[model samples]
Target: MISYNIFTLTNGLRVIHIPNNSDVAYCGFAVDAGTRDESENQEGMAHFVEHMIFKGTEKRHAWHILNRMERVGGELNAYTNKEETVVYSSFLKEDFERAAELLTDIVFHSTFPQQEIEKEVEVILDEIQSYKDDPSELIFDDFEELLFPSHPLGKNILGKPELLRKFKSNNAKEFTSKLYRTTNMIFFVQGNIDIKKVKRVIGKLTNDIPLLPTYKIRCKPLPYLPIKKILSKETHQAHIMIGSRGYDAYNDKRTGLYLLNNMLGGPGMNSRLNVSLREKRGLVYNVEANLTSYTDTGVFCIYFGCDIHDIDRCISITEKELKKLRDNKLSSSQLDAAKKQIIGQIGVASDNFENNALDISKSFLHYNKVEQPESIFKRIELLNSETLLDVANEMFSEDYLSTLIYK
Candidate 1:
């Protein structure tokens, strides 16, 4: 069992403290803004800003910011996804205060220098080119593009290099000022932390933060439409991704779908798809299924890479598994084993301190409360075969699936 304390500052910052006996501390902030918030013109600003913030800040130069943690045998990093941007770090418990102050500095006081912007733009352009060169990496974005036509959600997180060149330091400042609000952010820490001390240190760091009111530009919810396209690419193996929009994170049906996805093609080699496709016949080098859930929407997907000639046969096997899931219910023993497998998997994942903090922060950002891992297990326990069958049949139907292939 994990124990955590939740508090909100007067400036509207939500902080979560999970005390542990370990000497290393993991801490970070999650801003409820990302590529989804970017306007068409601002395609990559959210991600760009994430990189820029670390380059320099008002109180610290880029050197100081990078070395602040490393000097103490620590690490600092951040990432941007479609819906959130996170800045996090790991350090010895003794450097907790230093880590906290350094994080606060970068988040609130970044100075996006012109020189840094020019250099970073080149780096980003190279990134875009590299991403384009890898069909395995590029097809996921292409599949989403096919599914969501003319929508912000469909745009690549890494905007085109031409548009990225137009970004200046002022653009970074304006974008951060608009979206990085106290009300729109949460802080999470897991380590040998003193809750009161953390509150005081972070309180002092956030003292300068104005109680900025929140803003959200709600994108019109996208309607799911299945479209299939095959692209001829210069590649060693044919890559395919098939999927459709799925249940939102808040949907009651998601728990069943979660379990259903795990039973179908989750990470473990024992998954149904692996058993049916890889172990049984040895058709592909890699095959897996995944589901990405957002606040108001979600995506259910399966991805695989195989020989060009084997593409049709592998897809047929995949469809057969889907049909079995859609048309029939798992037997009593199979259902029990699936439940145990997913429950144990969730339990093991919760042991990851960094993932726990990040996940809890997002949960609070979305639900206004943290749903304990135990709560998830209970929900999974209540999921009967009937419930799973309903989810598989509805979410896995052939009509909603979209396929993208690179050959």
Candidate 2:
């Protein structure tokens, strides 16, 4: 039973509160600005701006902010994604207002100092280097590039090093001023607390924040290129990712796709991609299919890692397994197993306070509704073999497929 309330401030900020029946709470501050908002030269500005928010606020220095938060044993962190940026805190219910003040101050009154900008730029440069050193992360970047091509969405969230070099303190402030507005942000707080009080506090902090300008995100349509696989010779085991476009977050068939993804390659062990390829043939190490949904678009991807010499055979087997899924419906027994797996996962996630908080936040942020666990379970339970088949056809359709291999 997740009950919540939403309040819209005069400044245009939308504050949401979900009070749980537990002692601990999770608070999340999400902005609707992310990588998609970056200009061509400012690729990754949203993510860079995220790092700057913690540098200093009007009253609190970076170290002071952490010290104060830690004194109360509160957990504070922030992240930037393709469509949003978020600063989050988790603490006992007693520390909620304190945590909120610190978070709001950092987000609203950051004083992007020149020295701090230079220092954080180098830090972000190191972070980019770290990602480059890891083949798994690097190759995913490659896959996204191939999927989106010239679009800003195709660009890495960690803007290119050359572009980072061009970023000055003024640019950081400009980006922040333009994107981090009351209209562009959504605040979410969940725990055992008074929703009315939370709303009042948020309303005070955001009273003067202005609306964001109307800017259209331009993502030109990219045609499905030919299925070409590139092998990198420097790696040990072969890492592969195949993908194509899929539906936005609100698609009705999303629940069906969830079940179909399980049947294909999901959960811990009882999945077709793992069962057939790893258990029976003993050919591959691990394989899974996953989907990423956004506001305007989405992507469905299948990834696997195997021995370099077995790459061809791995690809053949993977394609065979996927084609089999598209060609045949799940058996009644298989359908039942997938439903049980989904229901069990939902139950486990909801039983805990923190997990349930995140689940509700994800619902409000992505799907715009707090879908009940039982409702989702009912959808999974009632869906049959035919629904799974239809989902498979929609997701695994061959019109726009791509594969990228890192040796």
Candidate 3:
């Protein structure tokens, strides 16, 4: 079992630390602000600000910020999602203070220079174009837009080019000043450093963070009507996505659905979808199921790319598999095997220290505490066939599912 420490700073920023004997350390900031937090006018401002953050700080130029950790054989990176943004680093344990201090400087004191905004916007625009060229990846964004309709949750994290060109430094500053707050951020560290030293270092660096009032409110998406969409595109293969909104982060049924997704189309080659589409019938090269849950909503989707001629057959087989899960409970042995498989997967994943730190940070961000591996294993162990059956019936029924295909 991995042990961790959690504490709150005087300014309301929360911190979590995991101690280990490794020479390398991982640390970062996970903020509760993301694409969904943006106003319609600010379509991709969250992600835009994330890029600009590295461009410069009040005291450091883009070059200085980029090299701060690298010069010492370390790395810095950041990413934005639907409901969260993370800026983190991995470096030698001796450079823990350097990493923490640099994270604070960029996240809190970014200058968002006008020249950087212009350059980064072009880069982001090119990125948007690259996605357009890959129908398989672009289909997922189109699917979500179809799933949520007019909601902000449906907006692509990469905003439209017309809007992207109009973004200025003021836009980034406005977005950050409004959403980035001490109360909405969590600082996380993982290394062999002493807990007291971690707290003291973070406390001094973050002491200037104002305890701003919370003004952010995430409105849950309204009920969605299922729709089937087939868009014509110039591609040799058909990329399809079939999914429905699943449980939120706080829902109890999420655990069962997670288990069900793993069995259906997880990363393992033996997953049902992989075996059916790739091994048994030789229909496609890749098939996988994904579940992405937010604070108040979630997305459960299955994606596959296949020869255009095989589209109908693949959909038929997919539906057949869903029906079987809804109609019959897993046998006692099957359930036991699934529980063991997922438990073992979780154990393997926990061994990745970088991902483990980020995972625990997210857990703490949502629940105000980190759940141990044993706790998660217990949840999986408690899942019975009835629970899985019910989850399948509720979430995987044909009526609740929506289909999006790129042909």
Which residue pairs in candidate 2 have backbone atoms (N, alpha carbon, C) closer than 3 angstroms, thus clashing? none
What's the lDDT of the predicted structure labeled candidate 1?
0.88
- Cα lDDT, all candidates: 0.88, 0.78, 0.92
Residues 69-155, model 1: lDDT tens digits: 998899998999889999999999988889889898899899998888899989888989999998888988888788778887788
Clashes of 1: 0
Candidate 1 Cα misplacement greater than 4 A, ranges? none
Error of 1 at 26 (Å): 1.2
**296-369 in candidate 3: lDDT tens per residue?**
88899999999999999999999988999999999999999999999999888888989998998899888899
lDDT of 2 by residue, 71-172 (tens): 988888888878878888888888888888888888888887778888999999999999988877787777877877887667799988989878887888
- Which candidate wins on TM-score? 3
The candidates, ranked best first by lDDT, are 3, 1, 2
How far does residue 98 in candidate 3 sit from its true spot (Å)?
1.1
| lDDT: worst 10-residue window of model 2 | 212-221
